[model samples]
Target: MTAKILRTRLDCVDYQEACDRIQNWAIQRNSCYVIAANVHVIMTAYWRKSYQQILNRAALVTPDGMPLVWGIRLLQNAQQTRVYGPDLMLAWCDRAAQSNLSIYLYGTTETTLVSLTRHLQQRFPSLRIAGSYAPPFRALTPVEEMADRDRIHASGASVVFVALGCPKQEEWMARQQGNLQAVMIGVGAAFGFHSGEVSQAPRWMMRFGLEWLYRLITEPQRLWKRYLINNPAFVVLFGLQLVRGLIKGQ
Candidate 1:
């Protein structure tokens, strides 16, 4: 099936085709940045200037949320699946392993990294992990950033998966691209989810667009503000954007 395009400023494509298309882009063009544009990610792209720059600079941005897929359907009639971070990690891992492309996981706590590597080895038997690094909790200074850049370059990895979460990962990816010679993907929460440190919602919940509800129930303290505050507000804001677009078009 052909990937349908959204009318919005950004390109909206499905996960599988996106995977093939991006890999092709990188192969033919010799460079590309593949960004997973989920609801939270899209909201960040919508509201934040720097984040928008980082995303817009990317070679490709796939719709990573069901609502976002539906939202695109509203404007472009495209049927796109959510190219979630966790699933994308698994997808790329499977592909990279087959293609002999080395990978580096750069984020999460030490425990999470250990578990993630262990799980990847078990799940994808031939996955060649070029390297893995767990950075400090606090923000990294320029020196620290440069050191990280050097580390990735030395590893000889063709794919660097940055799991620093949201804006941090996005920021890191944008900055490290020139320094690190590889495809840098900001895969938020994928490391944790795959490592079993974080639980994913049920398929039904996800299909019905209630994954956030399930997550909120699981970890209220950490995600209450995100769900109760940001989620609804994002809907309102996006709705307003749609209305505003309609008005301008008229």
Candidate 2:
């Protein structure tokens, strides 16, 4: 089967296997690595047709949130551990090091980008880092956007880790498809995770569906609406769909 065919509804491969798929695809050098991202993305998929199309069309969409795994299981019973963003970044970095694949860092603040680069270099002492950039917060003109793409192409990087959060990153990757010769993965908060600006929830908290809560507590000002409002709404919608599915089965 192709790497991303829905296995039940969980719609994901496990970790070591995810790494293998990415490495094999990177070796092929003809495609982008589209991360399935997280609950917000899956919730958006349910609410937004455009987001749904983006997820479905992605070459690979690994389950990046626990709620997404549950939703996938609700649709069809499937095992899926959270393939969260930070973990995905580490997986790709290790692969890049072992395979001699160069990488470019894009998005996030310049300070974060610098720290991430140095940390990766320290961890993977032999890793080839082709380049790094931090774009202005404002929208780019067509020429400016194309110029950035050209810079990445010129950097000779085989993989680009983009940290420009959610729909923005997904939209950016879609636009750059077949334009730059490498894989571009939109990794959300992974830049902060690797740089020590955010703390990861304990594994048990993640398993128990409270990681969002942990995050909400940590950054309540930024996340109150996303978790307190959106997450509950997602649960209610998903539960209804699951109930309907069960009834149909009987």
> The CA-based lDDT of model 2 is what?
0.77
Q: What is the TM-score of each candidate against the true structure?
A: 0.89, 0.91
RMSD of each: 2.9, 2.7
Tell me the tens digit of each residue's lDDT in model 1 across 46-81: 668778888878866776777777777776655556
* Per-model CA lDDT versus the true structure: 0.76, 0.77
lDDT, residue 214, candidate 2: 89
Assess candidate 1 and give its TM-score to the true structure: 0.89
**Candidate 1: residue 234 lDDT (0-100):** 71
Deviation from native of the Cα of residue 110 in model 1, angstroms: 1.4
True-vs-predicted CA distance for residue 208, candidate 1, Å:
1.0
